[model samples]
Target: MTTWLITAEETVIADGAAPHRQIEIIRKVHGNKTREEALVELHKAAKSHVPDSLKGTSRVVGRDSDGSCWILPKNGKGHPPCVIRFVEQIHP
Candidate 1:
C-alpha cells in the first residue's frame, strides 16, 4: 500500500504585474493501497475536493516521501486531464 498527496497550483498574477508563480497545495489525502490503487483513489479525491479557484489550473501530485513529482492541467469540468504532463518514479 502507498500514501499520496495531491495539490492544485496556479500562477497567480497581481493586477497589471508579473505572474506570482506558485504551487499551492489545495488538497492532501493519505491511503493504504498499492501505488496504482492510490493513484486512482487520489485522482478521484482530487476531482471532488479541489477548490473552485483551482478548478482549471494545474495539479501537483506527490507522496509522503517526496515532494510533488507530477504536474498536470485540470480538465476544468472537474476531472484530471486525459494525459499526465509530468511523472516521476516514486518507488524502486
Candidate 2:
C-alpha cells in the first residue's frame, strides 16, 4: 500500500526532502503516456483540470476499488458506492 505526505509544497525546496513529488512524474505521465495519449486520457477521465503543467508539485492518483488503474468513463449515474463516500489518493 503506497502513501504520501501531503505537506507544504515548499517543504521539498526548503529541505532536501525525501518524500515530495519528482518532476519526472509530471513530464512523463502515468503508464508512460505520450503527451497526446496523456491529453486524451485526462480529458476522458479527470473531473478537474489536472496538473500536467510541468510545475514542480505533487501528483495524486486514484484507482478503482479493485485497485485497477485506468482513466476510463464513469460506471453510471447511480452507483452502489454511493452509500459510503471518501476520497483516497494513490501515491506513486
What is the Å distance of residue 86 in model 2 from its true position?
Answer: 22
Ten-residue segment with the worst summed lDDT in candidate 1?
80-89
Tens digits of per-residue lDDT for model 2 on 1-92? 32211211111222465644322111223344344454444333333323333133333334445322222224332211111112223665
lDDT of 2: 0.30
The C-alpha lDDT values of all candidates are 0.45, 0.30
- What residue pairs clash in candidate 1, if any at all? 1-33, 2-33
Quote the positional error of residue 72 for candidate 1 in Å: 10
Least well predicted 10-residue stretch by lDDT in candidate 2 = 78-87
lDDT of 1 by residue, 1-92 (tens): 34454545555556699865454444344545565665565556544554444555675544333322333443444433222111322555
Query: What would you estimate as the lDDT of candidate 1?
Result: 0.45
